[model samples]
Target: MSRVLALLVALAAPWTPLLRAAAARPEHAPCAALALSPAPAPTGRPALQDAPICKKCQSTGRLPCAAHPRSDCLLEDEVLFCSVVADCTACAGAAWVPCTDCDNAPARARIEEKKASVATRRVALEYIDQTMKRPIRKAESKHFVLVWEMDRLKVDKKWLESHELLHLYLKRLEALYDDYCARMQITDKEFAEKFRVFVWQFPQDHHDAGLRFCRQSAKGGVKLMGQTPSYSVCGNKQNFQDDERLHRNIVHSVTHLILSAQRPVAWIGNIKAGWLDEGLAHFFEDRYWDVCDTYCYQEANTNVDFKGGRFRLAVRRMVEEGKFPPTAEVFQQNVDTLTLPMHATAFSYVEFLLNRDAERFNQLVKKLKAKVATRDALREIYGWSVFDFEAQWKSWVLSTYPTK
Candidate 1:
């Protein structure tokens, strides 16, 4: 026979003889066959005395040891000898040893498991790159890397993209503010010095999980939402995706950032009152909403009923009545709760005050900023009580836009 055929035949030989030997000399008979070494070992390492003759080796062997890296001892009678060197450079210095019955299956299984895990990780990373608008950089709080899950961000691709873009927009807005201040001859050294922005995207749990969207740290570090307002984006299912809604959400959230950035020294003292802080946010964001309305006119569709028509009437009435509320009261009675005849009332009221009389309104805001006390500040700015301001606003509404 040819050399290759002869070798094949030798390897294909039955293990019956080896099995008989095992039965006859159970104590010393090999349990597994030896495979041939691919290359000769260096001088130092011990070489196999001869090809192993275990039943498994004889039945399945080609040359050195097919099971050299691993073998099994069957009962106490059968000794499966593995003949491969543990640290042969020819074998890439890999250790070869008999597989223990206990760990053989698990070891092989672990290899497969690791392979799958690597594949999953690759997929998740690709999804993140394709879905996320910007690269998510690692954030540190003390020593921990804020490691979070992918599912927490319940917002979809568009929503997440828009949300993160808002963060980028804030940086742009800061630049814009710096430019505006410089051109207007305002010394913004103090204004620019007050706030530092920190963008966090936490893993979310569910669709509507509560993630901390935006918060001002005690030390004045601002955390802006990259997903929901209060929840982390690690474990949530993403769903938010209406373009208009997304824009509104971004504008609203960034407006908070801007106001927080420009927070006056006096307002900083009473920052705990939810009404005052949130109301101011509302006031600023409401104005921003108008600006967005004009800028993105095609996208401007009223999602909430702000009683705009009724508010216009109320403002007209208040103007005719020559009465307006102190800035403090407007800050006190949350703008959202204050009633109006039309849907856009609050928005219209803010628009009229800020757009028509920005100077006077800014003056009132400054005065309120100094006073801090809602009632006292209101009295000082508008010279009207809270109730009187409402009446005048309503009368103004009636006078400006008559229902009949």
Candidate 2:
């Protein structure tokens, strides 16, 4: 077999007899899938996209033994942190193995590298008063800073504060963040820490000022509903005078920002597949119904009022017309190449996977983020062969999707 084929075979069936023998041997007591070798600190900024994946650990930045030079372990709180599955008799202390699904390399090297460079290239903040004739003011909570043009809003500070609606909106955003962390099964401390959000709200008179602040054009692609730049974590909003539009846009854009700033596809030097990427973003867009705190429920087409239902309906039409791509093809789609139908299909596919088993879906997210091959990761994580996944996913879609 060719080297690539051999690797695929290994990935397809990781527990082969040879690997079993190696694991059983006393010298290689804990069978490690990948080998690790540490080198000196990289000179200058090493290519973020060029970090090599160890065949043993699959670029997870983990290893079978703390003795391995690349075994990313630390002596924290008198515990011997290691990624090995088996106990390390050498260190009688506790071991801190990464969740088999988690990928630490991006956190360890990629984010730290980019953060250092990003911190140096700061853009000056533009105050609204100097640019626009309207009365605009800024208010901030722990994670978000909002600058709004007073004339454009139906609800003012007095009304918002009195109704506690302003607090509720900010709290809603916070709840979204909490929901995200809970789904990923990690804490805020465990993720990349740069999460401060700045929102620029431009009512009618202040919309021009918002554009000027962001240095954006006033027409064409300048609808500028909301944006989260790849270079920074903040989002800019324009013309979202309605409460629902504002809420939906904030949830959507902020989801992208959090994913970018946290597990960070940039750190991996690759973009995620469109289906999971956009689907997760859309999924968060409807995580809460009308309120953030009280009685939240699962988001689905038959049940939820979120826009994802529209996407699911679009996907259903494609399915009936025989235009929807196969599961394998969808899995391979890049965001740049995805069509509108593809987006709909991708979102539904993610929802399908999530509904089947959310924990497994989350594992698939981690594995994919680590740049594991899609088919290999699916087999390893979900234990579903390609044939099984396609058949089941299609069946689930036709049955559960709304026809109306």
Worst 10 residues of 1 by lDDT: 75-84
Q: For residues 1-404, what per-residue lDDT tens digits would candidate 1 score against the true structure?
A: 33543454467567444343333443442334423322232343223333343453332322232333232111101111111121133321122222332233443453344334434433433432243344433211111112222222223453343323332333344554454334223455434333322223332221122222233222111234222212122211222233333334434434443333443533321332223333333444444343222111112233333334233444455545655344333444432333222213344444444544545555555555565554454466677675665565455456555442
Instruction: State each candidate's clash count.
Output: 66, 3
lDDT of each: 0.35, 0.48
Q: Which 10 consecutive positions of candidate 2 have the poorest summed lDDT? A: 292-301
- Runs of candidate 2 exceeding 4 Å displacement: 1-152, 155-168, 201-238, 264-272, 288-309
Evaluated with TM-score, which candidate comes out highest? 2
Give per-model CA RMSD.
Answer: 24.7, 19.8
TM-score of 2: 0.49
